[model samples]
Target: MAAEAIDRAMGALIGGALGDALGMPTQLLSPTRIAELYGHVEDFVAPSADHPVSKGLPAGAITDDTEQALLLGRILVSSGDRFDHARWVNALLDWERDVKARGSYDLLGPSTKRAIDAINDGVPPEQAGSSGDTNGAAMRIAPVGIMMPPEPLDALVAKAAEACRATHNTSIAIASAAAVAAAVSSGVAGSDWRVASDRAVAAARRGATLGHWVTGGDIAARIAWAQKLVRGKAEKEAIRLIVDLIGTGVASQESVPAAFAVLEVAQGDAWRAAVISANLGGDTDTIGAIAAGMAGACSGLSCLPQGRIARLKGIDLAEVRALAADLVAARNAKAGSGKEAAA
Candidate 1:
């Protein structure tokens, strides 16, 4: 229940990385093709050479989903937990350049790439993300949420929105990020899955008010529908329904709802959620990362496998744990400052 509980924070960061690695091989592939090739993936698998972005990635190798999330976490820690859109944009560009220099083809998402390009072409950083409406913001937002506690849903939504501002400024995108962040924050505070879900929805609705100028469909309504559709269905059927009706594509409208549905079907089991998401086909890594991150926040480090976490590449668990702690400290201190001022 304490913000200092490293287990939940570790669970969130490592769980998301594990999910990204598990789903990397199947990302952007069709469900039918994934079934034909891997036949119910239960563990980490090498990405096929077919997808150019993920080619040459070994088993247990994480993709941009985890990489960008870690980058965001580091940015948060370095900035004293402040959410600065310009700094976020600059960090992402630097990260992309570094990744490219390393000869890795796994690169930025379409929305993000374009936003950054626009920023480079003389557009202000704040104005660059206006065109973005993808789930890129929500995919890496667990760090922001993990640093927060249960109360003050408005501040959580605001921080989530600010985190999204670098590449996804639309209402749906911001709201989706808020939902994921709120879920993780509530879960880390020891709330049950049902309570976390309620907070997620409420925070999303509250975030939408902050984005009144940005046009998009209602994330809250979509998540509500997704929750209903997967309520009593079996795993396979739930996957089918999520893919067919809710969708699992790269768009915020599709992936965010699908992630929530996947988490619901898994009933807050972090490992099961990751497994389910890895086999769900389109944008598998991002969906798995989002769902598993939330489930991890709820279940903590105990639910994840140590062997698998040990095999994950490009991440240092100890460093991530430290950053999570620093973020918690920074946020609490800010909250305390606000309370003192209020008095």
Candidate 2:
């Protein structure tokens, strides 16, 4: 059981990285442009000079989505499962500095960049992200779900919020992130894909209440609606539904639901789900990363394509696996102590 759990965790991390890398080159292009340029982007391609954010990035290089996830995983292991918003922000600043030094134009999301700058200008950490309503938080929040103890949905929501409130405190962002995290946590613990999806929906609703209320549609409901659109449809039709109906923007409502819909459409096949997400055009990397993360968690590492796995660059799968192992250990210890305290 322990070995199997570790495998699922590895699958989530590696699968997410694969999706991020595969989608990097075509991230911001419209579907029409993608079709005009490459017909279909099923393999890794280097970003052309005309590419928006990743113009000069090497082929198969991960973007901020995967990079921030690795940073969050490191913070998880180091903080012993306690996420500190200040610490997370500091790490992002460091990452921005390093990326800038390397001359990469891609650095931070608009919401995240603005929030961090506000924090730097003396806004309190909790207040830093109050206005952020984008999907930035949800994109990197898989680790929180991976590391959190199961049950007590409230605790899971709280931990997810702790991880997200550094750059996205709005209910929309927090709820979307919680949904992703809950799915990953449940998936890693041996739940079936449907079970994990249900957990995610429930957690998203719960998480929305935990944050300062912002008038918005229910993220959980939107996810279910998106999933319903893919049912009984062909893969190509479902992909079109996701792109044309659900949208593929940076807004939590758009990208998060699109990720869930793609995962449902692919029935948790990591490669197919990631491919669909990568081809979704706008916010491709982030949507692919989320879908791939959930699929990977449910299916385990062996399900990922070996060719793509071999081509992963700039990120360390071994380290990601190690971080997952440590998070499991930390969660176990915390759970054991809680049991003892109850006794």
Candidate 3:
């Protein structure tokens, strides 16, 4: 069980990075532009010189999606399930500063950046993220799923919301994050993709009732819709429908649902899910990261290609492994305590 826990956690984390790296070059490009340039990004590829955010990045280099997730994982392990809003804010600032110091254009997402700026301008952290309605919350929430179990799902949703409160506190954003976290948690608990998807939908509904209300398509409904939308379709048709109807934008409603659709299209194959998401254009990296994280959790590390995993750059695999191990330990400790208390 311990070994399996570590494997699933590693799968979630590594899968997210793999997807982020695979989609780096294609992130902001349109599907048409992506087709013109790379003709379906099955492997890691360097961004073109004209690429807006990821230009000059080497192939297999992860972007902010994976970086932020690693950051969150580190925080979760260090803090031991106690979310520190101030520490989180400081970490984001430090991360952005480091990115700038490294001369990288990749930085915080719109919602995160705005919330940070607002906080800097004296807005309270809790209220600062009221305007956030993007996928920024969901993109970096895999760690929460790793540290928490899916049973007693309200606890999981609340924890996910706490993580989102500093940046993505809107209904849609929290719902999106909760959905991803629940799926990952369920998968870590050894649930199949079907069970994970069901947990995700339920968690999204619960999460929607929290956070500042925002007007957007229902995340739960959209996820169910997306899964059904992609069912039994050809890969090309599914991808087209995802890009055209489900969307791949930064909006939580769009990208999160699109990720679920991509997962369905790939049939829970982490690598295939990442590849499909990478070619979907728009916020490809984020969509890929979220989809692949869930897929990896369901399938475990064995499903990923070792050669491609070896090609990944700019992340410490040792630290990621340690974090995963530590999170699983923490999860076990919590479960033991809960059972003891119940007895």
Candidates in order have lDDT scores of: 0.83, 0.85, 0.93
- Per-residue lDDT, model 1, residue 208, is 75
Regions of candidate 1 where Cα sits further than 4 Å from its true position: 1-4, 212-216, 338-343
Distance from true position, residue 175, model 3, in Å? 0.5
Best by TM-score: 3
**What TM-score, over all chains together, does every model reach?**
0.95, 0.96, 0.99
In model 2, state the lDDT of residue 341.
83
Error of 3 at 172 (Å): 0.7
lDDT tens digits, residue span 73-143, model 2: 78877876567677789999999999999887778998899899999999987788888888888888888
User: What's the count of clashing pairs in each model shown?
Assistant: 0, 0, 0
Task: Give the candidate order by descending lDDT.
Answer: 3, 2, 1
Q: What residue pairs clash in candidate 1, if any at all?
A: none
lDDT winner among the candidates? 3
Whichever of 2 and 3 has more lDDT, that candidate is 3
Candidate 2: the clashing residue pairs are none
